[model samples]
Target chain A: AQSVAQPEDQVNVAEGNPLTVKCTYSVSGNPYLFWYVQYPNRGLQFLLKYITGDNLVKGSYGFEAEFNKSQTPFHLKKPSALVSDSALYFCAVREGSDNYGQNFVFGPGTRLSVLP
Target chain B: DARVTQTPRHKVTEMGQEVTMRCQPILGHNTVFWYRQTMMQGLELLAYFRNRAPLDDSGMPKDRFSAEMPDATLATLKIQPSEPRDSAVYFCASGTGHMNTEAFFGQGTRLTVV
Candidate 1:
């Protein structure tokens, strides 16, 4: 089975400070990780994805995530936070493409509040 | 931008009435997914189709819920005799279903069952 866990339900950070939203996963085969952000009354927007590449992958809005195979973690990070950056973050995991089929699992989500 | 398109951005219906949601996936995309989002349950996959073929619908309620892909671009989800519990924001997403591809999402249909 494939699963995703976002340990924090909420995270608060001051403006211009670095922000980190934690994510971990468990999958039977190689994992494909993704990060998405959702604002009120809007759809989930893709931030970034990790297929197979360097440990660190940069994405939109100056956001980046580091893929750690040993730790099974793909933590979303930002060098500086903005008040507009506040939104709900979701971590999703899918099993590597193969002959088998499994549902994509999404984490419970973490609400980020960037205080000014 | 090229994205998934969903019809009837908002719908309100009485209990026991039938509700239908439609989606048009992105061009050349082979995979389509239907998901329901709520405060309590979060996001739950209702069904998905690949190449206009029904692949997995186990996540949906078999008795009252039905999903089908009439063509490569058109996918539909129907719920007969809907209950208040069925009220939620339903989203449609599209992907290539190939290696290392990310899915694009629609604005979603907010269904309120009164």
Candidate 2:
């Protein structure tokens, strides 16, 4: 079983300030982690994924996430926050290819409120 | 430009009425998923299918909720006797065979059961 957790229900950041959304996961075998953003009235759009290789993975809209194996956390980060960046963020994880099914588990979600 | 498309972006109906939501997955994608999103529960996986065959639907309410992939392109979720608690955004997603691949999501259908 693969499960994810986003501790914070809401995060507020001032514009131009660095922002971080925390995520942690528990899974069997290997883990395939993903971050997604959802704007108002829109579907979730892929941000970045940490499959293998580099621990720091860059994604769309100047967003990035670092995969920390020991800590079992993959936190999404941005150098500077923008008002438009305020949205709902989700963290998802899947059991390694060693497993199957649509068993993609998602976190409770974090609402980012970037103040201008 | 391939993406999942969902129909009836917004639907409002009284309780006890049947509600059907449709989804068209991306071409060549072999897996389809149905999820419900609400403020309280966040995102909940309702069901999923692979190659038009249902693999697991334990998360769904078997009594009133049913999902089917009639064809490769079409997937539908039906709810009978919908309750107010059922009001939420239903999202449909699809992905290829690769387990590591990411799933593409539809804009979602906001179903409001009054």
Candidate 3:
């Protein structure tokens, strides 16, 4: 089964500091990883995705993620955090092959707080 | 902008009452997905359809819950007898069903069963 794990339930970071939201995955075949952000009362917004490309993929709002095949991890990163960056982050994984069907397994989510 | 749209942004109903949520996908999208969001379970896939056909619905409780895409423009998820535990935000997303395409999400319907 394809699954994603976000180890931290909450992450605290200071404004202007780099922030990292960790995510790891388990899948039978190659994995298609995605990062999404959600604000209060809103649906999940797609941030970035790792298909088959370079290790690092940049996304919206100055966010990026690095796909590590050996580590089976796709960690979301930002060079500098802002107070508005505070939100819930979710990591999702789907098997690269079609065998797993169309569903993508999502992580429990990590709440990120950027303190000013 | 092209995006998925869900109706009944907020709903409050007594327990045992029927609740129905509706979604309209993007114009050219071929796949639609239904998901429930809660603090305990996070985001879970309740059901999904491809080409207006039900593809998977195993995540939903079969007894009281039913999902249907009556036409290309409309999709509905119905709960015959809702319970308190069913209170949560239900989201609908649509995608092109092609490899590497990300699903676009609707604002979601917040259902509260008292």
Candidate 4:
């Protein structure tokens, strides 16, 4: 079974400062990881995905995530944060195998709060 | 830009009442997914369909929940005799068959059961 863990329930960051939201995964084979963001009363929006890449994957809204194979970690990062960046984030992983259909296992979620 | 569309943005109903939600996926996208979200359970994939054929529904409750794509454009999820525990925001999403492709999501239907 593929699973993801978000270490923190919430992360507080200052505007214009860098921010990091940590994520780790457990899968049987090579992992397909993803990050998504959700605002209040809205559905999730895709951020980025790491399939078989160069480890550093850049995404929308100046967000990026690094896929560390040995550590089993995929942490989201933003060099400079904006107040609008505050939202709920999720980490997901899809099992790697012969399964044609992708079933995503999502983390509990991390609430990001950016202080102005 | 093309995106998934969902109907009945909000619904409030009594226990034991039936509720239905609808979704229209992006044009040309072959895969459709249904998910439920709550404060406790971030996001749970309820079902997914490929080429309008049901692929996986293991995450959903078989007794009360049913999802079907009657046509190429529409997908519907129905819950019979809903309980307060069923209250949550139900989301509809769509994507291509490729693993790297991103899935687009609808605004979601917030169902409140009393």
Top-lDDT structure, candidate number: 2
- Model 3 regions more than 4 Å off: A99-101
| lDDT agreement with native, every candidate | 0.91, 0.92, 0.91, 0.91
DockQ of prediction 1: 0.56
TM-score of 3: 0.97
**Residue range with the least summed lDDT across 10 consecutive positions in model 2 chain A:** A94-103
- Tens digits of per-residue lDDT, candidate 2, B1-114, equal 998999999999999999999999999998999999998899999998989998889999999999999999999999997999999999999998566789999999999999
**Candidate 4: where is the Cα deviation over 4 Å?**
none
DockQ of each: 0.56, 0.66, 0.56, 0.61
Candidate 3, TM-score of its B chain: 0.98
Docking class of 2: medium
Task: Give model 2's clash tally.
Answer: 0
TM-score of chain A of each: 0.94, 0.94, 0.95, 0.96
- Whose TM-score is higher: candidate 3's or candidate 4's? 3
Enumerate the chain B TM-scores of all models.
0.97, 0.98, 0.98, 0.98
What's the distance in Å from true for residue A109, model 1? 0.9
Instruction: Quote the positional error of residue A63 for candidate 2 in Å.
Output: 0.9
TM-score for each of the candidates: 0.97, 0.97, 0.97, 0.96
lDDT (10s digit) by residue, model 4, range A22-110: 99989988788889999888888999999885989999999999888888989999999999999999998877465454867789999
The reply for model 1, stretches above 4 Å from the true place, is: A97-102
Q: Which portions of model 2 miss their true places by more than 4 Å?
A: A97-101
Q: Candidate 2 lDDT, tens digit per residue, A30-100?
A: 78899999999999999989888998999999999988778898999999999999999999997755535
* Candidate 3: C-alpha lDDT: 0.91
What are the per-residue Cα lDDT tens digits for candidate 1 across A24-103? 99987888889999998888999999988798999999999998888898999999999999999999998855733345
